[model samples]
Target: MRADARKNYEHLLTVARKVFTEQGNDASLRDIARRAEVGLGTLYRHFPTREALLEALLRTSFGALAKRADELQASSDSADALITWLQEIIAFTHEHRGVIAPMVSAIEDHESALHASCVTLRSAGAALLARAQADGKARADLDGSELFDLIAALAWLREQPSHASRADRIFGVISGAILARRP
Candidate 1:
């Protein structure tokens, strides 16, 4: 990319992050272009779709979450690692707002722009869950897909204003159900 084009791309990403943080992932692309002082056509040239823009914005976050999972998996107790990663991922999705839906949708849609990142995030959490289950700290009946679904469900709950206050308590209940009792 040319220097000016790269600058515009980075500036758009920065402005988009602020807009998304304030208005959520569903914030208007036109508004982002306006905020970034770029033409709508320029924005489209850089990110052809809303999901493409989101994919660019969240790529680093997705990788960080995956890396955090690896760090937690190696450094923490099995059950603790799974729960911690769950809490972190829920926080991540909640922080972005409105992203959970697309993420959930992307998990099953191979053609989605967000599919690869969502899959990587899910696989990271799944690995932690697997470690917990292998250590006999988690329920044997659960699988990676179910765990991913649970994360999506929990993250979605956090998005609801009515349920936001109860999210932590609800998370505790769900996590408790996923774990085995100590002897």
Candidate 2:
């Protein structure tokens, strides 16, 4: 891509992320182009469909999350690392709630990109949980699948307009439950 084209693409992603957050996944792509100071043709050239745009956004976001998990694993305290990772995930979900609904629907509809994202997140969370459990900081019985379910539930809850704060509370409760000292 040309320098200007790359710049416009990045700008579109930034504008689209904010627009989707404020206006949901069905937000106007034309308006996004207008806000980004790019033409509608440019937006379509970069993101051919709504699903394509959503997948790109999620891939970008989740890729960062996976990197954070890797960094957390390299940190000193395993328990604190797990807590920090969970907190970051919760914050990401909160910020991307508008896209969550459509991404989830796409997943249910067998979208390959969304499925790959789910697999990546599941693997990252499992690695973190395994490390925490092995270090004797987390519950030995809690599997990755269970933890993923909890995160998904929290994400869905965070997506609701009325339940914005619920994700934090849920995270706290889950962290305590998983990391509490065993008798």
TM-scores for all candidates: the values are 0.97, 0.77
Please give the distance, in angstroms, between residue 67's alpha carbon in candidate 2 and its true position after superposition. Answer: 1.6
> lDDT tens string, model 2, 1-183?
999889888889999988988887779999899999988998999998877877788897788888889989998888898888877886787776565565455544665557777667767888898999998999999987777777777777877778876767776787899895966
Runs off by more than 4 Å, candidate 2: 2-8, 34-42, 102-110
Alpha-carbon local distance difference test for all models: 0.93, 0.80
- Index of the highest-lDDT prediction: 1
Report the error of model 2 at residue 71, Å: 1.5
Model 2, C-alpha of 172: deviation from truth (Å): 2.1
- Cα distance off (Å), candidate 2, residue 77: 2.8
lDDT score at residue 136, model 2, on the 0-100 scale: 93
User: How well does candidate 2 match the true structure, expressed as C-alpha RMSD?
Assistant: 3.0
Tell me each candidate's RMSD, in Å, in order: 0.9, 3.0
